[model samples]
Target: MSNTDHLTALKDKIQAVEDGSIVAITMPVNIYLQEAEDMARCARIDIAELATINVTEVQIDDLQARIGACREVQSLWVEDQHKANQAEDLWADIQVQANELKSELIHTFRYAYRKDEHLMSAIADIAEGSTNSDTIQDLNDLSVLGKGNTDALTAINFDLTKLDTAADIAVNGADALAVANGSRQRGSDTKVLRDKAYTYLKESVDDIRAAGKFLFRNEPKKLKGYTSKYWKKRNQSVKKESDVESEI
Candidate 1:
């Protein structure tokens, strides 16, 4: 698909949230990844240049030494092999740094893309609305806008409260939505209120997932892997519980 089409599809997928009214939302992860790829490509090019320099420096050093060692030396060719060695060392260091950067870029891409998938799924869920009739009835009952003798003013106030709470959480959370906003104030800005609301919904999905993991920790279905630094720090209670159980 064309780039425009791809972006449109992505937007459509996200916009499905809240009966397609959440069109203001943008995926910060995707945006950041695109910029990161550009930066990584540039760094790779620089590394390639360093590699070339290393080869040229070594070759030139060897040529100069060969000529200097020749007899009938009227002109002295002072070959600074030390300088060439230093250049080789620097080039090796640059290659190592570049490789590390590339690995980091790959890891970041995987993480961000996974997050994007989750957000898209959440958006789809919100779009589908309530599937169960009983749940739908209950939601309609609790909805401030529904037929419960609630006037438009009251409904608007309730929505404002929900939106405000969501915005506050999104702004404080590590989700790319807030990061994409460039500044915290932008999240609260009138121009991006809808966008903030969309991000809040996205964060709600994260909260749900975290809660599920906590609740299902004892189940055998729980997969083992490296925990994120943030989760490792925050999930101390789980670790403590596990340790206590192991002792028993």
Candidate 2:
């Protein structure tokens, strides 16, 4: 394959692994071994069939190098899957903390307001437009408006404005908390796929090793012996020459 094609294949494999579609390690050993051998055989045939391409040794070396670099990137990326859970946990904790603080603040405000009857009465007077002049009420009492007390009215208006502002802020903050909580939930949902990918990829290494041993148990076709050497040589050859990188 061309360098770009090779890298694309690797990317597709990694994506499949991450998305929980690649089941290389989950298949029966015999079947996996058979598929692997078939792939190797086809690869050899394809290389030999490319005899008419007029390909040069330098070009082959460069392609191999590119493939090696792609592999290094794939390895690093797969290894980083462990961090997915950490992020999910962090977002969950943040959501909890945010919600707790919001609830506590709201509860405290309600408790304080309910405990103070004078404060509530002032608010009620403002709502009902009560102007009983025989009693001296707090500035929040709308009677201050009838008394032509602009200063007290302004202060009451300011307090009312503050209440409105506080209500708006609380609403907006609740919405934000809901969104944050949703994000944490979504992250938790995708965690299963990530976990499966990590488990499958980790076990696949041992599975391949076992398959190699099983394949070589009876015969000496040298296929088992050449697995590492063949891929190493191919990588080195492709590195010396390659094509323009392509997006996945």
Candidate 3:
């Protein structure tokens, strides 16, 4: 194929892989495997065409040997895929256990103390406006992308660690507030509990924002509203400073 034709064909292949068509139990995994297979077939075809284009026998043999080496790597990838599937299954099971525990705790203790009406209300308010759900979803994304380059993955892991710590602190603070308000009236440690909750809530928000800023810093277009504007301006200023420094 001509260069333009090859480019168009590659684009078509990429689109087909990205189309999200459901041909199996899981669309993404199947699509990725199919894409790999297609690319390997294309490589074989290209090798055959090269052999027919007046290439030396030695060159063809070298190409064939390289293909064999790649096939060996592909076999190693199959082993990696099997291990990844096991890890994913284990993670799913952990999620189920965690969800069960969360449900049981809420059901068994949320309303056990009738005098904890104010405490329960505080918890509800916190839950209603919480960024914990988004934080969790981002963490899942980070985990799934863990196989990327070591430096990039390490940066993501660091941000996730910060987020996890902040989330834990917020959760612990909420639990403490709940315990404090469970027994005492408004005249007791109510203010203390409120202050604790507020401090943790603010910390959670700050940490979450920091994580998001780092996560999408390279793709400011993906950010929304104030975040998009802020990052865009920040990126432009940094670029300008770097350019001036280089000129100096």
Candidate 4:
């Protein structure tokens, strides 16, 4: 075939293989989704449990007791205001953690989807003979691209790690900003710390994006059959069977 014809033929083969791989990819995607959902649900349940315990209730009660002991209403009001401020601070910290977990869940889903796409593309290239066969000796080779225990597992662990790191940075940066804002209201020195925290947050976001791009890069080869050896083995088996039948 001419080069153009060969490429066209290869494309057709690739399309067929891609169709098959898409079906295979679905199983892994579902598995990853289930695992991610379970994890997110567990985290939310834990947070809810903590909230139910009403640990903050103790602090509020302590504040009330102190207020009752004060002779002046003004002094009681000041204590109450301080306690309210502390409660607000605690709530903000919880909010940051919740947001971080939400971001992590999103990252997990995206990583799983991306992994599915990569596997499908790789399988297509292999079926089309467009990739180096040596690079993908079998399905095991394809599994290495994923983060699971076996080659068949398509979990993208590396992507998850990067996302978690980014989430931590974002949560910490937001907390720092809240602190700086509160400090400013009290006429305390905080501008320098705020600037530093913001810079770190920006760097963290950039790193996350870079890591995602690296993971999403295209594979150069695909997995293919060892047709020549397979055919040779088949012929040998056939010949042996024929000789045995003749002897009979």
lDDT (tens digit, per residue) of candidate 2 on 1-248: 64345445444454455553534434333333344444344334444333344333343343343333344443434444444455546545544543444344333333445555765554444344222211112122222332332343354343334333334444444455455555556655444433343344334434433444454456555345425444556677676555323321
Provide the overall lDDT of each model, using Cα atoms, as 2-decimal numbers: 0.34, 0.41, 0.38, 0.36
Off by over 4 Å in 4: 1-71, 113-154, 158-248
TM-score of 1: 0.17
* Residue runs of model 3 more than 4 Å from their true location after superposition: 1-53, 125-248
Instruction: Give the top-scoring candidate (lDDT).
Output: 2
lDDT score at residue 18, model 3, on the 0-100 scale: 23
Q: Which lDDT tens digits does candidate 4 get at residues 113-168?
A: 44577655654543343221222232222233333322232334434344344444
Residue-level lDDT of model 1, residues 131-163, one tens digit each, is 223222222222222223224325334333432
Q: Write the per-residue lDDT of candidate 3 for residues 17-51, one digit (tens) a residue.
A: 32233122222322333333343343343444334
RMSD of each: 30.7, 17.1, 27.4, 37.7
Worst 10 residues of 4 by lDDT: 219-228
Give the C-alpha miss distance for residue 86 in model 2, angstroms: 15
